[model samples]
Target chain A: MTVYSNCHVITFNYRQSGIMERIYLDNNATTIVDPAVRDTMEPFYCHMYGNPNSLHLFGIEVRPYLHQAMEQLYSGIGASDADDIIINSCATEGNNTVILGFYFNLLKDTRKKHIITTQLEHPCVRESCRFLERHGVKVTYLAPDRDGLITAKMVKDAITDQTALVSVMWANNETGIILPIEEISKVCKEQGVYLHSDAVQAIGKVKVDLQKVRVDFLTFSAHKFHGPKGVGGLYIRDGLNLPPLLHGGEQMGGHRAGTVNVAGTVAMGKAIELANASLDFENREVRRLRDKLEDALLKNADVLVVGKRELRTPNTLYVSIRGVEGESMIWDLNQNGIAASTGSACASESLEASPILTAIGADRELAHTGVRFSLSRFTTEKEIDITIEVANKAIERLRQLSTSY
Target chain B: MAKSDLIGGELWEQYSQRVADRMNNPRNFGELTESDAQKLGGRLVIADEGAESCGDTVRLFWIVDEKTNIIKKATFKSFGCGTAIAATDMMAEMCIGRTVDEAAKITNLEVEHALRDQEDVAAVPPQKMHCSVMAYEVIKRATSIYRNVDISTLAETDIVCECARVSLQTIEDAIRINDLKTVQEITDYTKAGAFCKSCIQPGGHEKRDIYIVDILARVRAEIERERNPHRTLSAEFAKLSVIKQFKAIESVLDEHIRPVLARDGGGIELEDIQPGENGIINVHIRYQGSCKGCAGNVAGTLSFVEQTLQKNLSENIRGVVV
Candidate 1:
């Protein structure tokens, strides 16, 4: 059949559809800035550009936006009060602040120089705990089981009377496995040790109620949802005192200093609002697309899905194809205008295998070949179909080309 | 629409068009089979190189004519990032039609420059520069195999950061280009100090002759000397008599090395100094007490004393146990 009627048809089709069509499946890395959030933040760049720290009208006008953002975050995350939210940079910085803040406060008490965390935490928390270890603070990194789930009993067994704080991630970035935060929190509470949960990957993907979880602190970034980057927040329990992480002018009640990022805060508020509104659709439609993509890819004998037996984020599907290299598969997918990521950072010049995958007892070969496809509410059934087809073809080509196979 | 803003604005923009082109269509991918290798007189050389920090590995194959020493074909199979693939592909392509000796001269810079679509632009980002170095190493390895020499003997350049694959020359270049004044900036630009960080200073997971800190200080001093050429104190010190150098070395050892060695009931004595070939000062030493039979005396304490003397006294000092 004559697929191309003329040169104009070819040019138009290529311009309008072929190269223009992009299938993004790496939402765990970062999400696209939402149009609604961008619209909400647009006016702040010039028209509403004012320092919230200033006392003049320009600053006074922007203060309300920051307050609104705080309120939105507190309500969205199910915090007890808006005053407990400390807005800062990305989730990494938020995690660092809370971790270091806890450590700094406990420094005076030599008896409490120990911290407990999981091995599958995002690199930020893991690195923070390592830094503490380097500075003479004892740390225990609890590795997850085969399903990428860290048990509450593991935390309880690891915690000693000397433990000062316990930090665990609500959801893992690579495997999408959800840890038992409530159970871990209860154990921490019985032991009288502070508990913090890095909810960066869980805030929008799953429901997080501070009332139910009873975590002493929670950390998340806005960009994990549809908000802009450079904005994250930390939730501290009311009546708990944390030393200021950032020292300067009095800001956030002397907890963190530096002028507030007004537009980013506003966009974060709008994004969280939109995320909460669409939570049902995300758990249903997005989950459906993710499941369909995983099921279709599993038709191949080589394909193995990660965290299948554990609770995971609705939009994330981590899979490893035997004998096919994840880096090569991602490059091939990119050639076909698709976006994805490997679970392991090894292929990208950092020689370490995916600690998360390895922690879950995946062999080196399987860990190296793991690919993570994190979906969003914006993902469509058509995109899922295209992703399945493209990914299968790419995996087949890579497996054939792989010399080790 | 989403092409430009995949990861973010500037981070994704750091990659050039050549990187994308080569990643999608690698020039000389895949290894030659046994029969295919027989076409070039059965002198096919295969070598593998791996980056420790990121488990990326590259395997290179070369078909060399033994009589002519000319490489007829070059191919590679890389399990790594796009930069590694592109760099290895370009490296293999650059090797073909050239003599094995000539191919051995290919540096990571040359591989990167060849992959550049335009002049004076980096083919990859700063962090990905190690990929090019990995390609350069595999070429040396293949050449070593062809020449029937040990790969370590074939390596002429000193590599400081094994994890980042950063050579001494690359580290100096980064310092000079970016005017990197601190170890952090050097790590940011060249990633040398980012991994095991043994290259950061004396105490780390690994050890190197020239740490990133030393390279930074040397480059900065060279810049200062270049700005003011009349400075002659260091040069005069270098030209001092061997006896005078020995005196300085004795003082350094007595002050820094002996006290630490004394803690372990060990001491080091300077026996003689002879000016060896190529301006290398061969200083002979005899270990006393428990140090004479200690394993660390030869392995660890020897380097510690030598490095201490070199840092405090002269760069030409080379300590040898008698």
Candidate 2:
């Protein structure tokens, strides 16, 4: 249901396919699969499909592909070891499992079940904390740097012996500010408390080295790297006894259960392989296009790109188009066959102030009015130009609409 | 839209919610007329706590319940959001279950003390502790009415802005909830507006009804009419003063006296006519849609009008019964 009057909540069905435009800028939400990755997973979807947990040859045949996907995901992020990767349906599930699983262990042990997390963490992490708080767990919300960055010292101060784990996003989903995960992971490491990082936005866009950062857990969405949606991998440091988030049949070696989605695994693996292989090309080209978009918006609209400029992902721009409610501008662009996101889409219904924006000390109006434009490997210069043109119009029009209100 | 829609619309929603809440569960609305309340103050307590101390500066509203028993719901209607609303809503809620005697001694300090640790509960913020002051006052006013005592300045203080509810909590909550930056936005959301008119009984504002003394006026007129007999002129005295009074008033000669007078083809004038010289001011006036210069107007109206004026004004300046 479209819980509010303002939304397109319907799932993509064949009904909309004919009318749907090809250039969708809401890649940060999800993206089209890479052609190379699609070809790689074609066999699994039709012929080689099998439950990897099965003992039969057909099942065994898919296991290698799943393992290969995990390795690519691990290697792509420069993981020191492959066994740390735990495959899951999506980054949200991975984030929940890490946070909840850690809490369960703490609750079970009768240890101090406190968690320290940044206000900038996603709803997957933030809501999980809220849920856990209702369950009698204490949480200390770490503040961000003025530009919405969190330094290692904030993590150091926030953590206590009672702190079961610390979660900080590797890069902000909306702004793409690369947080000081390395320094924060160091703090958590020294404190002997576990650290979980939501690396879904960070992994493919930037360099992440479990080899360097040493977070206890990390989550990545395969779709973020042109993989199939609903297939992600979570990295758990070896020998941390985490409680499983879900249970049923003996699958994922009993860590996670129920039959595996074989096609998802295959496509995820293929997408990761291609993404890893084309890393520099995708990275440089998308960044070039993003710069073009960002520069044009800045030069033309005089907008402030939220978060620090130097330490951000090249494929995304969180522009504060002043004098416009971000959601209205997003809708305006949407009507023009362009796609973008307000800082608070998907969360529009709660109508709650964004904790992230508030944490960053964003001006309340500006926080609510922030818009993000994320680019992917398929994003072209022409696409950037179109977005700028559409954005300028949307911003101007939305500004007018805002005045009437 | 209908008047009901205006009262219930977005314009009035916030105030109505606040008023309803105070009416139902004023934060410090219930009475505390405990035998133990003797320690609170030297009285049978039946209003807000902290009410015994004068100048507590609380803001509260009183509404006569369907019971016709006064319901005092208190809040710092002056205190400004959720805390203000919460205290008002909560007090109103709790007050419903209590008695007039219990509502007094409802103190802000007690409500504040109740809310101090309930950051998790739906209590107003700490900064808005004073709103309980108003909630406290509502209880006292309701108590006074219950006892039939007159309340003046003690009850309705100058409401800062009827629409905004800008008391400490409303302002603070507005500043905090939507993170509103300016006073204007706070006004918009909290509705510290005056646009939505509240037509309270004309009797209530000055604390007296104009209609109540109307009967006494009629009675005094009757006494004067009895006191003075044979008061005014033989119709030959077409007094200019009486004619001027009628002219100054709507031409009853037109509405009530005009037609008959027009038929007479002679008219009255208003020069130096003494009212008592015209007994009860009983000029028998008659009328048509158009005006009348009635010849009998001097006899028609002089006495009854004089008596009516003398009776209503009560001899502000006594005059002849003419």
- List chain B TM-scores, each candidate: 0.55, 0.25
Q: How does candidate 1 fare on TM-score?
A: 0.70
Q: Which lDDT value does model 2 have at B40?
A: 31
Mind listing the fnat for each candidate?
0.17, 0.00
Candidate 1: which docking quality band?
A: incorrect
Runs in model 1 deviating more than 4 A are: A1-17, A38-72, A81-83, A130-136, A246-270, A322-327, A343-358, B1-16, B34-54, B62-69, B104-107, B137-322
After the best TM-score superposition of candidate 2, give how far the Cα of residue A397 lies from its true spot, in angstroms. 3.2
lDDT by residue (tens digit), candidate 1, A203-239: 7888888878899888888999999989998888988
User: What is the DockQ (computed on Cα atoms) for candidate 2?
Assistant: 0.01
- Please list the Cα RMSD from the true structure of every candidate, rounded to 1 decimal place: 12.4, 29.3
| Per-residue accuracy of model 2 over A1-405 as CA lDDT, tens digit each | 111211122122213434354467777777779888778778887788777767899888887877777676667777766346777899999999988897777754677789998888888899999999999899988888777888999889888778888888999887888898888888888998888999888766777777777888888888888888888877887777677888877677667775777777767767766766666875788888888888888875547888766788777788876555564466446545677777542123223345677678666455556778888888877777877877787665444323212
TM-score of every candidate relative to the true structure? 0.70, 0.54
Candidate 1 residue pairs in backbone clash: A350-B53, A350-B54, A351-B53, A351-B54, A351-B55
Q: Looking at model 2 chain B, which ten-residue stretch has the lowest summed lDDT?
A: B196-205
True-structure RMSD for candidate 2: 29.3
